[model samples]
Target: MKRLPNFVQLKEVGPRDGLQNEKKWISTADKIAWINMLSESGVKEIEFTSFVNPKMIPALSDAREVGKQIKREPGVLYSALVPNMKGLEFALDAGIDAASVFMSASETHNQKNINKTIDATYPVLDKVIREAKQAGKLVTGYVSTVFDCPYEGKINPDQVLRVCENLFASGVDDLSLGDTIGTAVPTQVEQLLEVLMKHYPKEKLILHFHDTRGMAIANIMTAMHYGINRFDSTVGGLGGCPYAPGAAGNVATNDVLYLLHGLGIETGIEEKKIQDAGLFIQSKLGKILPSRSLAYFANAQ
Candidate 1:
């Protein structure tokens, strides 16, 4: 039997990725309160918002205000997503601890999502990574559609590797592989990690899996066997890609914590705290969360 890791790290993305897809506008005050609550949950990193044009993603239009107002918690790193130089400037002005730049592994998907070819996106990201580093902020590179793409069915593993290599060469401190549409299976995950681990250290990689096909946990387990310990999850499973039709929210934070805790892996996050955060957001949004653990907790209560 493969030994599981003794500990794992979780970066909460509910405030950014989770909220970006919502059609309903979440008030800036609500966003700040939710992040402050997450900060108290002992999560080491939280993607608080995105520095994109408000007209593009009105849901997070108040990114700067949210970034400025959140009560910074000691030991918790606050990060924001940046698409270009302008966004990076906003993130820097807001004193973001880290900045994440994202692109897709599928050429068509990249064009659809960012309206740019894969080649065009890289130079922009390279610039963002360079500027972010110069500003003394940690940089995270996100390669979306690593598992599958809505426009282009199966993504070649080589393509994923190439993007990761470019991001690393661009001086990113961390890399996150995203199952954008959640079409990945365990075998595929194992195969990709087999190749990725050879070049990149497991510590610098993070897995961001969506539960669209109900395989998120299974995929995580496969990655764990390969010693990949960091993951990006959203509270209450709160996000989906607007460009990827039929895509679902990310694998829930509560659910991930449950799996890790059951396997005797330390995440340093309290389950109750996460549940509270989930419930709070669910209520504020007036929607029931899709997380099984969250549902179970609500039932038990």
Candidate 2:
């Protein structure tokens, strides 16, 4: 049997990715409350919001307010997604612990998502990375649609590798491979990781998966088999790709923690606290959360 990692890091992306697709605008106070709850749950990181054009993603227009008002926990690293230098400016003004620059691997997806070609997007990202690094902030690079794209299906592993390499060369401290539409299978994940591991250390790579086809857990297991220990998840499975049509919510943080604890893997997160946070957000969103474990926990209460 392969040796599994003794610990894993879970970054909660509910406040940002989870709410970005919502048609309703979440109140800034509620966003801060939700983030504060998550901070107490022992998650190492929380992607609080995206510093993007309000007209582009109006749901998070209060990103600045949330960033400034949310109570920061002692150990939790607060991060924000930045699409360009303007977004980075907002993130910097808000004093985030980290800034994430994102672009898609597929040209069509990149264009559709950001109104920029793959080549055009990188210079912006490079500038963001350089500036963030100079400001002494950690920068994370997000390669969306790494596994597949809605506009163009089945992304090539080489394309994904090239995007990651460029991000590293641009001085990003960490990289996240996003299964943006959740079309990845375990075998495909294994194959891609096998190739990616050759050029990048597993320590610096994070897996971000959606649960669209109900394969998120299986894919995560495959990644664990390859010694990938950091993963991104949303509380209550509350997320969908606004650019990738028909994509579902991300893998639930509660569900992932449950699985890791069951496997004797330490994540240092309390599932009960996460469950409460999920319930809080679900009630605020006025919808049922898609996390199976969370649903069961709520019913058992």
Candidate 3:
């Protein structure tokens, strides 16, 4: 009997989203080690690396090598960030199967983060999407600050839909709407999703949320109620928004898995193994994790 689609797609963005803005630079070996452990824990897709200027983001200085070294298992995906064609080349050379491209829905954040206006960034992002599609690469498009922006307070759903139009026209396979600043609540999530679903397919859209205000899991539950099945999360909540300063990381992997399993939704992620990997990675970084729920399991001796 083929069950109805009642599962969630958990894309582990820890290697890229979680570590990109860390104060201390984690070595390439440690990154590779962490991702390898995550791959074994049944995360369907992992953002394994990024292709960007090392001088700009020293955290992922070894993007090329990290993508090359991570052990890829069957039924699991290894994705990287290709900021441009140059990035696409490096990721292709590293044998990456999928790549994610980023842009912001708010004009203020677009210029602040990428130093370009919305009009200017749109064409460039379109070019990246076109080229990646032509290269037979699975392209995932990310629109950051869908809920709110530190500089541009209260994002409009119309702005989000406009950006989605450009991205879909450019041939993106998956679209991820990000709550980059963690300013979203359950009501806000449901409101934006209502508008987003009218324009985009629910299957290709993913939610990338931050836990700065501690409502990340609640927002996820609200999204579930609205029929959203895919979500982006980090291990042990080990990340923050580079654009949104002082913001917390995405919802924790173990906590989300626990919630999903308790609700009888199949996520295919092993709860204990993921918590264990979170423990291993957090120890290597030597910092207290932000996930209150993960802390209980990680701290229990």
Candidate 4:
């Protein structure tokens, strides 16, 4: 058996990916306060908002204000999703510490989500990556549907490799491979990692899983077996894929913490604090979230 890592790094994406899919409008002030709470939760990184067109994702329409007004904590890296130069400009004006650009491995999904072909999307992302680097902010490239696509079915590993190669060549400091529809299993994860690990170091890779089929934790364990240490999650399982029909939210940070802590791994994050953040957002959404840990804590109380 492979030894699990002693420490793992997690990036919180609740504010951006989490809220982007909600139909109910979350007040900008609530978003800011939730992020401020996360900033103090010992999470080193948070994807606070996306600077996309308000018409595209109205939930985050006030990205600039939330990004600018949040009480940024020391040692916390604040990031925002940027789809183009224009979005990056807004992110810069908001004092973003990092920029996240995304595309899907599936051509069909890329077209549907980004409204651009995979080939056309690269140049757009390349420009964003260049400008973000020039401004001294690290850039993260998110490749969605790395495991499976709702429209395309199982994505060929070669296609994922091609996207990863292009993103790395385009100067992204890190790559986040997303299980967009959460269809991946551990065996498939093992197979894909064997391919990805051949070219990139584990340090440059982060796995983003959505627990749609409850396979995320299993797949994460497989990634850990391959020495992956960085993972992306949302507080309270607050996000779902807008383009992928029937897909669930990103794996809850609370659930991931339970797994990591049960294994005696170090994350430097306090579980109680994360639970509090989850409760805050749950109240705003006015619904009990899908996170098992969050539910357990709420029930236990």
lDDT of each: 0.91, 0.91, 0.85, 0.93
Residue range 138-215, candidate 4, lDDT tens digits: 999999999899998999989999999999999999999999887899998998899999999999999999998989
Clashes in model 2: which pairs? none
**Which candidate, 1 or 4, would have the higher lDDT against the true structure?**
4
How many backbone clashes can be found in candidate 2? 0
Q: State the displacement of the C-alpha of residue 194, model 2, in Å, after optimal TM-score superposition.
A: 0.9
Over 1-301, each residue of candidate 1 has an lDDT whose tens digit, in order, gives 5899999999999998899878878888888999999999999999999998878888899999999999999999999999999999889988899999999999999999999999898899999999899988999999999978998898888899999998999999989999988889999998788888888899889999989888999999999998999999999888865455545689999999999999999999999999999999988877777788998998899
List the candidate 4 regions with Cα displacement exceeding 4 Å. 241-247
lDDT of 2 by residue, 21-66 (tens): 8986778888899899999999999999999898988999999899
TM-score of 3: 0.95
TM-score of each: 0.97, 0.97, 0.95, 0.97
- Evaluation by TM-score, superior candidate among 1 and 3: 1
Query: How many clashes (backbone N, Cα, C below 3 Å) per candidate?
Result: 0, 0, 0, 1
What does each candidate score in C-alpha RMSD?
1.8, 1.9, 2.8, 1.8
Best by lDDT: 4
- How many clashing residue pairs, candidate 4? 1
- For model 3, where is the 10-residue window of minimal lDDT? 240-249
